[model samples]
Target: MILAVLLIAVQVAAQDPRLDRLDPDTRAQVTAVVDSARLAGLPAEPLIQRALEGATKGAPGPRIVTAVRRLSVDLGTARAALGDGASVPELEAGVAALRAGATPQVLANLHSVRRPPLTMALSVLADLVASGVPADSAAVAVLALAPKARDADLVEFRRAVERDIALGAPPAAATSIRVNAGADVLNAAGPPPPGPALPRRP
Candidate 1:
């Protein structure tokens, strides 16, 4: 019976070759979490990776299992907010946003208001919160731009807000101004033009 149990555990956790590095005991526990995630249709790779990361850091087996379980729960929460059709990247971004203090309702709201492939927008929202902007204000800025802004536009807007914050503007104030002014941080001449046009070639 014990041999049968060990074989099943190995089979369940063997999805990733790298997981072979974990001790047998840790592998079995982490495998349970990864299995539950896969059964729920959630991406299992991230959970596996998290366990491997903890192992790499030389954490105890219990610690590694706890971390993997927490990530699995987070993944489930993210999927609930992003909906069934959300891609793996979107759910991953939602997890990051949640960890950064953005609420699940904020994610659900973004899902309703924004279009598909929310990976970049969620990333930006999480980055903004990490940069000290209040989560609600950051959500407002992202929601304001989500209707029409492209992914590249969101990146530029984030940079501009960070710049303003670095220059002493309050985080929320900078976010509001950027959203109202639009995400064209590289406006006028666009990214290609440095200052004036300079003379073009010889």
Candidate 2:
């Protein structure tokens, strides 16, 4: 019975289509990392997906392994920053934000103010950094807008910053100007009225 069960487990494990795309040694390494991630209560899907992405790009086994391992570490760091209650998408975005140089303290501060679906805000921060905005400046800009900016506001803000940069404004200067403009608009609107109480998550 034990041998049969082991055989069934092996068959099931072999069914992941991604595994077939890797050489035996690479497959073994990735599987081990994925299993370790699972045991750590981390989502393994991103790591798996990253491995598949590497394979699709024809990366070597060692390269794929390195990518997966790095993503695993990033995801773990994201989880630590955002806490266990964070959703998978939130964690993913957090990883991107971290990679773009958003500090852990910045993430924690954002978590304190924003509700779920922080993906958009985090992505915008990453975009700003990628577009040459200094990481600290980008974090400040995003955090300033995050308290009151809706999803549309975030999109518009990103476009404005990008446009300014394209127009030859220095990234830090452009971001600072836009962030200040946003703050002015908020201040002009007066204090926000109290809404329904959002229960704090422990």
Best by TM-score: 2
TM-scores for the candidates: 0.82, 0.88
lDDT of 2: 0.85
TM-score for candidate 1, please give it. 0.82
Query: What are the per-residue Cα lDDT tens digits for candidate 1 across 1-202?
Result: 9768656655765666777889988887887788767667788889988887998899999999999898899989988988888888998999999998888988988888766789999999999999999999998889878866778989999999999999999999999998888845434324442344332211
Candidate 1: C-alpha RMSD to true structure equals 9.8
lDDT of 2 by residue, 81-187 (tens): 77777778888999999999998989988888776668899989999999999999999999998887776788888899999999999999999999999878877
For model 1, the stretches where C-alpha displacement exceeds 4 angstroms are 1-15, 183-202
TM-score of 2: 0.88
Clashing pairs in 2: none
In model 2, how large is the Cα lDDT of residue 123? 88
